[model samples]
Target: AQSVTQLDSHVSVSEGTPVLLRCNYSSSYSPSLFWYVQHPNKGLQLLLKYTSAATLVKGINGFEAEFKKSETSFHLTKPSAHMSDAAEYFCVVSDPGGGYNKLIFGAGTRLAVHP
Candidate 1:
């Protein structure tokens, strides 16, 4: 089975509003979870990650996510949204089972922050 799945392909939020992006994952071993954001024609930046160390992870630009092992979910959330937050978000997973880190990327979720 695919290791990572992003529940939404697109999400829209008004400026100064909250934003949420859903993701789920399945891994054989303890995995590292990451949320990456990409601006238009730009490289991706890591927003946050859960490495079996913390359940609640904080990230830059007022973003955060909680790792729920029981639910097998990691969802990104922001209390207030900004226009600059409009971009494509990816949920990534890294499994260290094979002695090497194998990164798996979700299809992607495009977030639109409106004015």
Candidate 2:
């Protein structure tokens, strides 16, 4: 079983400020980690992925996350926040042991960018 916990349900930031969203995970097997961003009423777009390959993964829209096995964490970070960056971010985990290759999504962190 693989699971993810998003530390913040909501994050607010001023435009041009740094953005950070925290996440933690637990998996039975070596799992794939992913961060997905969704715009208003839109589908999820893959920001980055950690497939037992890279410890530090970079994603689109100037977002990145580091997979820390010891801390059991995969926290997303961005140098600057844009108005467009205001959206929902989901922390996901893929279980290799599970045959279906389903991704479990966190409740989601809603990012609000203030002008």
Candidate 3:
């Protein structure tokens, strides 16, 4: 079975500061990791993903994640935080047999940006 855990339930950052949301995953095989963000009144949006191609994967909105197989972690980071970046972020791992249909999501981290 594959699962993901988000280290923080809430993260607060001042505008222009660095942002980090930690995540750890457990999998038996090479795992597919993803980060999704959902705003107050919107659907989940794909932030980034890792599928054994590159350790460092970049996504939209100046966000990126590093796939650390050794640590079983794929933490999301941003050089600077923006007001629009505040949202509920979920760390997800896909089922090896189920493909895109089956996904395991973490508890989620709520990001709060302050000016």
Candidate 4:
């Protein structure tokens, strides 16, 4: 089984400022970790993923995250925040043992971008 914990329920930032979203997970087996973004009623979009191939993974826009095995952490970061970056973020955990289609998502982090 795999699970995720989103440290914050909300993150606020101003335009052109740095943004950070923290996440952690646990699993019986090595799991595939992912970060997805949802804007309003739109469908979820894949931000980035860690598949044991690389430690640091870069996603769309300026978003990036690092998978730390020892800490079981995958925290997302962006050097500068944009107004359009405001959205709900989810940290997902998936295990091949569960067919890879099953994903356990975190509660979510709402990002509010100020002008």
Tens digits of per-residue lDDT, candidate 1, 1-115, equal 3399999999998999989899999987777999999999999899998988879999999999999989999999999999999999999999775577877899999999899
lDDT of each: 0.92, 0.94, 0.95, 0.93
lDDT of 3 by residue, 1-115 (tens): 8999999999999999999999999998799999999999999999999988999999999999999999999999999999999899999998876545478999999999999
Tens-place lDDT per residue, model 2, 1-115, is 7899999999999999999999999998777999999999999999999999989999998999999988999999999999999999999998766477888999999999999
Off by over 4 Å in 2: none
lDDT of 4 by residue, 26-73 (tens): 988877899999999999999998888889999999899999989989
The positional error of residue 37 in candidate 2, measured at the CA in angstroms, is: 0.6
In candidate 1, which residue ranges exceed 4 Å CA deviation? none
Considering summed lDDT, which 10 consecutive residues are worst modelled in model 4? Answer: 94-103
- State the TM-score for model 2: 0.96
Whose lDDT is greatest here? 3
Q: Which ten residues in a row have the lowest lDDT in candidate 3?
A: 94-103
Better of 2 and 3 by lDDT: 3
Q: In angstroms, how far off is 111's CA in candidate 4?
A: 0.4
- What RMSD does each model have against the real structure? 1.1, 1.0, 1.3, 1.2
Q: Is candidate 1 or candidate 4 better by TM-score?
A: 1
TM-score of every prediction relative to native: 0.95, 0.96, 0.96, 0.94
